[model samples]
Target: MSKFDDLPEARRRGLEKMEEVYGFDMSDGEGDFFRYTADHLFGDIWQRPGLSDRDRRLLLIGLLAGQGAADVLGIQVPAAHANGELDDDALREIVVFLSHYAGWPNGARLNSIVEETIAKARRS
Candidate 1:
């Protein structure tokens, strides 16, 4: 059977939200990390109504940049663009603005990832 076949409502919702946010199916994910990700992070935190998805994306982008989390940002940046939460110009502006606060080095890394992702998106 599939991992998600009999999941609780919250986890099920979380998986669906994960797919929506990341622009890919997450139903195949397994293990403790994936469970918590779906059950808490996506299910509870992401489901909060106070922030729009765009607002959350912006916050997450800044946090990820500040943390120098290029790998996660590699996923988030493209998903944000694909989900209409951020366009090319907005993504570029984020790199430019965050570079000041997040530090030039992290900003440089973000710039590279954003540029590469945008280019790849355009070519597809």
Candidate 2:
């Protein structure tokens, strides 16, 4: 079956938000990775019934921050914003809140990345 076959609604929204923020194009050569992300990450994981999308985004922010995954976090920040999962204040607060557990350097770096992402989003 195709990756999209029986795709859950939450997964579809997640992919749409990812594309909107990251300029993702499934037609691009990175089909395998994209399909894995869509089929497994979003389709299965995001479809789990407990958390709301906002809750998922908040958890993602913390996890990405702790992992020092600034590049991915950069993409996620805007995606959360576009999805109405996070606002500017909430984004800044996440940096502050995560700084204690994720370390100052990671938080500082993410703060800068988040600012840049927000600026770019506004420009477009």
Which candidate leads the pack in lDDT?
1
Q: What TM-score goes with each of the models?
A: 0.92, 0.73
Candidate 1 lDDT, 1-124, residue by residue in tens: 4456588887888988898899987764679998889999998999998999899989999999999999999999999999988999999999999999999999999999999989999999
Instruction: Give each model's whole-structure lDDT.
Output: 0.91, 0.74
- Candidate 2 on 1-124: residue-level lDDT in tens? 4343355664565565455444554422246777677656765677679987788878888999999998888778877876667887888888899999999999998899778767877898
Q: When superposed on Cα atoms, how far off is each prediction in RMSD?
A: 2.4, 4.5
Q: Clash number for every model?
A: 0, 0
Top TM-score prediction, candidate number: 1
Residue 67's lDDT in candidate 1: 99
